[model samples]
Target: MCGIIGIYGNPEAARMAALGMFAEQHRGQESCGLAVSDGKVIHLYKSMGLVKEVFTDEVLKTLPGYIAVGHVRYPTKGAATKFNTQPHLVETLFGPSYALASNGDLVNYDQIRARLEAENVYFNSDNDGELLVKYLAWQIIAKNKDVVEAIRCLMKDIKGAYSCVFCTRKELYMFRDPLSIRPMIWGKNINGDVVVASESCVLDILDVNGRSEVPAAGIIEVNADGVKVIGNNPAQYRQQNHHSYCVFEHIYFSRPDSYHFGENVFEVREDIGRKLAEQDKGLEADCVVPVPDSANFMAVGYSAASGIPLSLGLIRNHYIGRTFIKPEQTIRDESVRQKFNVLPNFFKGKKVVLVDDSIVRGTTIRKIVRMIKLAGAEEIHLRIGSPAICYSCYYGIDTPHREELAANRYSLEEIKERIGVNSLKYLDMNSLRECLKEPDEYCYACFDGKYPLEKE
Candidate 1:
C-alpha cells in the first residue's frame, strides 16, 4: 500500500500535503512526492526518499499551490525510483496539466496499458497509477470532456482496487475502488482547509478535525466550496460492511499510532500479543525481542503479558535505501539481509520470543530465526500479531504466492521445524477478531480468503 494526502484552500497547500505525507510515511517509505495548484498552474516535486529527505527546503520552494496533492509510494508493481515517484502530472490536450496521487493497485492495468499502447498512446512510465492517468487523460482529450466525467467513464474499464486523489489547478477529486481494499480518510484543518489522507493519525498531526472515513468505493471531490460526491455506480460502490480493508495496513505498513477499519492498530497489535500468549501456554521462550521497527510495538505487549523483558535483537540499517529493487530473487534476499544486522549482544544466552508483524513467504522471518540461532539464542518461540496469511492479497499487499505461503503449506509445527524455532504460534482468527473492539467492521480477507469486492 501507499500513503496519499490532499489539501485545498491553503496558501501553502503543497507544504501542508508534504507534512501529511510525512506523518503517513510509515505507510510507504520508497518514494515521496507533492504536486500543488497555484490557481494558475500545477507545480510538481517528488523523489525517491522519505518525505523529509525528499522534500528539503529547496524542493518545497519549487512547488507553489493553494490546492495540492501528495503521495508516499510503496510499489506494488512499478519500480520504486525517482522515475516513478508520483504526483504524476499530465498536460491535457484541452486544459492545463493535472496531477494524480494513487494509494492502491489496479488489476486491469496490464489490459488497459495494452489497449492504450495498441492505439499508439505514449506511456511515460510503467507505473500502474501513471497508466491510469494516461488512460483518463487520453479519454478526456478524445471526448473533449471534463476530467471528472472522463474518470467516471474510465472506472468502467478498470478492474482493480484503489483509493486515489487527483488535483487540478482549481479542484481536488478523490475516489475509492468499489471494493475499498485500501483506506482513505478526509478531514478539515482548523483553518477550514479541506484535507484527505490514508489514515487519521496524519490529520491529528495537522490539527484537522477527524471527519468520518469516506465511504468505500465512493467518490468525493473538494475545491474552494468544500467536499461533495460527484460520481459512483450503485452496483460497484454498493455500501456494505464487507470489510475487505487490507490487513497488512494494520499488521505492518501503517504506524502503530494510527487508527483504521474502526480499530486502533496499536491496541489491536497489543491484543494480538496477549492472545498469542494465552493460546501458547507452555512456550519456553526466554526474552521477548522484536524483529526490528515494525514489530517493536507488539513485542512490548508480548513482553508485558508474557512476563518477559523486551530487547532489540535485530538492528536495522536505517540508511539502506532502495539500492536493490531489482525484480530478482537473489537480490531481494540479499537486500533483506543487508537491511538488518543481527545483534548478538542482545540475543546472547537468551531464548527469544520473537515478535513480528506478519509472516508471508516466511523468507525474512526464516532468515531472522536463523540469525537468532547463529547469535547463540538458546531457544526461539516465534509469535505473530496477525492471523496467518493463507491467501494472496488482490488489494495492495505484496504477499507471496499462495503455494509459497508459510501458513498454507506448513502447519505451525512444520513451520517451526523449517525455521528451527523452538515453537511457533500464530494468533487464532477468532481471537484476532476479539482483539478488535469492532470485530465485524474491519476486513480480514487475507486471513480468511474472503474478498470484499467483486471484480468487474
Candidate 2:
C-alpha cells in the first residue's frame, strides 16, 4: 500500500503536498516523490527515503507550482528503488506533460504490460503505478481518448485496487478502483484550493473541513473550468454486487484519526477491542496493554469493557517506522527489536492482556512477547483485534505469498506455543463483521480466503 496526495489551484502546492505526505508517512516509508505543475511544465523530485527526508523546505521551494501530485511508496509490485518510486512522469514532443502517482496494486499487471509492450510502449519500472500511468498515456496519445474516457476504459480492463492522482500541466484528476478496495478522499481547503489524499487526516492537516470519498469507479477533475465530480456504475466494471472495501485498512493500516468506508477507523478498532473483551468474559488480567500506536484505541475499549486498568507498559520509538510495513524480513526483524520497549519498572509480576491489531507472519509479535516476558510479566494473554489472516493479500499488501503467513503455516495451538504466550485468541469472523456498518460491503479475503478479485 501507498499514500497519494494532489493539490490544485494553490501556489504553494508542493509545500502543501509535502505536509500532507508527512501526515501519511505511516502508509509508506521506502520512498517519497512529488510532481508539481507550474501550468507550463511538470517538475519531478523523488528519492528512496521518508517524506521529511526527501522534501525539505529547500527542495519544496525548487518545485514551485499551482498543481502538485505526491506519493509515499511501500513496495509491493516492484523493488524498493528510486526507479520504482512514483509520480511517474511522461513527456512528449511538446514538453513534460502527464505525471501520475497511485496507491494500490494491479492484479493483471503482467498481462497489461505485455499488451502495452506489443504496441511498442517502453517501460522503465515494474511498479504498478508506472503501468497505470503508461496505460493512460497510451490511450490518450495513441487512441486519442480523453482523460475521462481512458480512465473509464481502465476501470473496465485493469483488475485490482488503485486510488490515483493524475495531472497534466494545467489540471488535476483523482480516481479509484471499481471495488473501492482502498481509501481516497478529497476536499477544498479554506482557500478553496482542491486537495486529495489516501486518508482524511491529510485533509484535516490541510484545514479541509468538508471531505468526501471519491466514489467507486469515480473520477474528479480540477482545472480552469472548475471542479467536476463524475460517478461510474460499478456494475459496468466489477462483478461484485457490493463494494469490497479493504477491511484491513480500518484494522491496521490507516491512522486512528482517519475516517473511511463510512466508518471511523479508531471507532472500528475500539469496537473490535470491545468484542474481544466480550469473548473473554471470565478471563482475569491485572491490566490491558496495547502494542502501541495502531492498537492504542483497541486497548482502550478492551480496558473499559473488561474493567481492567489500562497501562502504557509498552513505549514505541516514534523514530522507527512500522515493522510490518518494512519490506524485507530482515529489516522487519531488526525493526521489531528497535521499535518497542517495556516501560521501566512496569510489567513486573503482572498478568497483562496484550492487545495487538493482527498477526501476519507472527515474527514481530513473537519478539514483542519475548520482550515482555523478559520484563517479568507473570503472563501475557494475547488478544488480536482481527481474525486470522490465512490467505495472502493480492490487492496492495506485501503478503503476496501464503507460505509467509503465520496462520497458513501453523494452527492456533501451534501458533500460541511458538509465540510463547500464556493464551491466544483471535477475534472470530462473525465478531469482526459486527464491527463494521455494512459488513457485506467490506472485503475479508485475507481472513476467510474468499477473494473478491484474482491475479490474472
Candidate 3:
C-alpha cells in the first residue's frame, strides 16, 4: 500500500501536497516523490527516505506550481530503490506532459507491459506506477485517445487495485479501480483548491469540504474551468457485482482517526475488540495490554467488553517505522526489537490479555510476547483483532507469499506455542464482518483465499 495526493488551483500546491503526504506518512516509508506543474512543465523530485526528511522547506521552495501530485511508497511490485519510487513522470515532444502516482498492485502488469513493449513503447522502471503513466501517455500520444477515455481503457484492461492521482501541465485527474480495493477521497479545501488523497485524514488536515470517495471506476478532473466528475459504470470492467475494498485497512493499515470505505476506522477496530472479547466468555485477566498505536482502539473495546482494566504496559519508539511494512524479514526482526519496550514494573505478576491487529510473519509478536514475559507477566492470552491470514494479498498489502505468513504455515495451537502465549485466539471471519457496515463490499482474500480479480 501507498499514499497519493493531488492539489490544484493552489499557488503553494507543492507545500500543501507535502503536508498531505506527511499526514499519510504512515501508509508508506520506503520512499516519496512529488511532481509539480506550473502550467508550463512538471518538475519532479523524489528520494528514498521519510517525508519530513525528504520534503523540507528548502526542497519545497524549489518546486513552484498551481498543480501537484505526490506519493509515499511501500514497495510491493519492485525492488526498494530510487528507480521504483513514485510519482512517475513522463515527458513527450511537448515537454513534461504527464505525471502519475498510484496506490495499488497490478496483477496483469507483466502482460500489459509486454503488450506495450511489443508496440515499441520503452520503460524506465519496473514500478507499476510507471507502467500506468506510460500506458496513458502511449494512448494519448500514440493512439490519440482523450485522457478520460484513456483512463477508461486502463480500467477495462488492467486487473488490480489502483487509486490514482494523475496530473498534466494544466489539469489534475483522480481515478480508482472498479472494485475500489484501496481508499481515495477528494474535496475542495477552504481555499477552494481541489485536493485528492488516499485517506480522509489528509483531507481533514487540509480542512477540505464536501469530501467524498472517488467513485469506483470513476474519474474526476480538475482544471482551469472547474471540477468534473465522470461516474463510470464499474460493471463494464469486471464481473464482480460488489466492491472489494481491502478489509485489512480497517484492521491494520489505516489510522484509527481516518475514515474510509464508508466506516470510521477507529470504530471498526473497537468493534473488532468487542467481538474478540465476546469470543472469550469465561476468560479472566488482570489487564488488557495492546500493541501500541494501531491496536490501541481494539484494546479499548476489549477492556470495555471484558470488564478488564486497560493498561499501557508497552511503550513504542515512534522514531522506528512500522515493522510489518519493512520489505525484508531481517529488517522487520530488527525493527521489532527496537520499536517496543516494556513498561517498568507494569506487567509484574499480572495476568495480561494482549491485543494486536493481526499476525503476519509472527516474528514481531513473538519478540513482544518475550519482552512481556521477561518483564514478569504471569500469563499472556493473545487476542488477534482479525481472522487468521491464510492466503497472500495481491491488491496492495505486502503479504506476497503464503509461506511468509504464520497462519498459512502453522496450526492455531502451533502458533500459540511459537508465540509463547498461554492462549491464542483470532477474531473469526463472521465476527470480523460484524465490525463493518458494508462487509460484503470489502475484500477478505487474505483470510479466505477468494481473490476478486485473478492474475493474468
Candidate 1, residue 219: the lDDT equals 71
| Candidate 2: tens digits of C-alpha lDDT, residues 290-344 | 9989999999999989999999999999999989989899999999889999998
What TM-score would candidate 3 get against the native? 0.99
For each candidate in turn, the TM-score is 0.88, 0.99, 0.99
Candidate 3 lDDT over 267-304, as tens digits, reads: 99999999999999989899999998899999999999
Model 1: ten consecutive residues of lowest lDDT: 320-329
Q: Report the Cα RMSD per candidate.
A: 3.1, 0.8, 0.8
User: For residues 234-294, could you state the per-residue lDDT of candidate 1 as single tens digits?
Assistant: 3653446354566676677777778777778787777777787787667666678887677
Regions of model 3 farther than 4 Å from truth: none
Worst 10 residues of 3 by lDDT: 88-97
Off by over 4 Å in 2: none
